[model samples]
Target: MDDATARTQLESMLAELDRSITVLRGDPDAPGDRSLADAGADLTDADRARAMLDVAARQRTAVLDALKRLDSGDYGRCVDCGKPVPEGRLAARPEASRCVQCQSVRERRR
Candidate 1:
């Protein structure tokens, strides 16, 4: 994807993430049904929300980092190995900071 497309996608994702945070903040205390099973379900919902929030946070960071790279004229290079990341991979994940090999190695380490 081109820089314009990447920026647009990142902005959209950021907005969605902000909306999600607003929803979560609006429900600071989760309401639960009377039954134990129902309460458990509420906890499950909270867990899912938390997980989504985490993902959003990471995505936001990734986008911001990508933006910085764009500004520096280093947008398409892998952060880990300083290699040019494939356009196909960038199309798949615009915020990727590592080439496939480097990313795989990083993931394996994690």
Candidate 2:
């Protein structure tokens, strides 16, 4: 995808992620505001929220990194192999930093 399109998508993703993270975190300044984890524990709701928050935070970081790459004119290029990541992959995950091959290899190592 072109940088403009990618930027728009990435920015939208960033905004949504930010909202998710904020809601999960809760408003600390409010009256006795507790986090999602603190608000509920029955049926492991707190644990579930914590897990979701962690994932959202990590995804947010990825989006930020992708934005940096876009600014640097390095977006859509695999970080490991410097190959152009497929358009399909970018469309699916705009924050992706590796081609499928490289990503597979890295996952195997992990």
Candidate 3:
């Protein structure tokens, strides 16, 4: 994908992630409005919200990094191998910083 297209995609992803994070955080203005009387149920909901927040935060960071890479002319290059990440892969995942091979290895390590 072209730089312009990639920038647009990254910006859009960032906006969506921001919105999701905001929703996951719930209303900051109302902190003591727990409807559930059961402490276990409240804890479960809080735990789920925390997990969603963590995922959204990670996604936001990736999108921001992708934007920085665009500024540095390295948006489509794999950080691990310095190879030009495939355009199709970039199209599918604008925040991807590794090519297929490097990503596979990284995932296997995990």
Best by lDDT: 3
> Of the pair 1 and 3, which is ahead by lDDT?
3
lDDT of each: 0.82, 0.91, 0.92
lDDT (0-100) at residue 20 of candidate 1?
74
Better model by lDDT: candidate 2 vs candidate 3 = 3
Quick one: RMSD of model 2?
A: 3.9
Q: Give residue 8's lDDT in candidate 1 (0 to 100).
A: 80
Name the weakest run of 10 consecutive residues (lDDT summed) in model 3. Answer: 27-36
State the local distance difference test value for candidate 3.
Answer: 0.92
Worst 10 residues of 2 by lDDT: 38-47
Tens-digit lDDT string for candidate 3 (1-110):
99999999999999999989888898645656565475678788889999989989998999999999999998899999999999889989999999999999999999
lDDT of model 3, residue 39: 62
Error of 1 at 85 (Å): 0.8
Residue ranges of candidate 1 with Cα displaced over 4 Å: 24-26, 29-36
TM-score versus the correct structure, for each prediction: 0.81, 0.84, 0.90
Judge candidate 2 against the unseen true structure and give its global Cα lDDT, from 0 to 1.
0.91
The prediction achieving the highest TM-score against the true structure is: 3
Report the Cα lDDT for candidate 1. 0.82
